[model samples]
Target: MSIEVGSKVQGKVTGITNFGAFVELPEGSTGLVHISEVADNYVKDINEHLKVGDQVEVKVINVEKDGKIGLSIKKAKETQQPQRPRHNGPRNNRNDQRNQNKTESFEQKMNRFLKDSEDRLSSLKRNTESKRGGRGARRG
Candidate 1:
């Protein structure tokens, strides 16, 4: 059977490695399910998740020109939760615009940054001069 990108297919795990697991697709074809693509969460060990001869359903993410196939187990499974609707009507947009208006403009932000830096530098210089009390003075 010919495998196409974005197609969900069942395959058998033929081999396991540190990086990923090798799966045998239909018609004697094989693909690599990368460690990241194995699950939705962090996958520390491939052996813990898959073993030799285990059947898994994977989504064909990419088919390289060199005949290498990329598969994703996470994408194959559908999410159980219903999606939330977006609240982006005119009323919500007015609130967003009000929030944006509260932010400082480029020149205003630069002036604030310069003033803070000048204060910090003056304070540092005073502290340094007070601590030195005469750089080359003899301790005696």
Candidate 2:
């Protein structure tokens, strides 16, 4: 099968190494799937996730003129949540907008912040009783 970028295709995992997995596409064509492309998140280890003989759906990322195809497993899965349908009327939710307008005045917020800061300082002072020595006074 001809592989093109963005094409989703099924292939068999032929080999597994520390770095990547070799996938044999239909028609006996093969491509290298880098470790980064193995998952949607950080792929710390590829072998733990895939083994030889496992069939996988992968997206073709690149097809070079020299016939080297780069594949990605992460791109094969669409991560986006399905889009929500828009309401067909004006957004007259005055309650939400009014609540967004700060009910607490700036002065009240500042007072609360300063009081919290004092409590945090006292807590830090009480907890840090390691009794460690400090470096000697430095000279200019």
For model 2, residues 1-140, the per-residue Cα lDDT tens digits are: 56778888999999988888999998899998999999756778897889999999988999988998899887787543443444434453434444575787888768867997999897666556433332332344
Query: Model 1, residue 36: displacement in angstroms?
Result: 0.3
Clashing pairs in 2: none
Clashing pairs in 1: none
**Mind sharing the TM-score for model 1?**
0.58
Task: Put down candidate 1 lDDT per residue, 35-98, tens digits, no spaces.
Answer: 9988666799988899999999988999999999999888887443344544657776756655
Q: Cα RMSD for candidate 2?
A: 10.5
TM per candidate comes to 0.58, 0.56
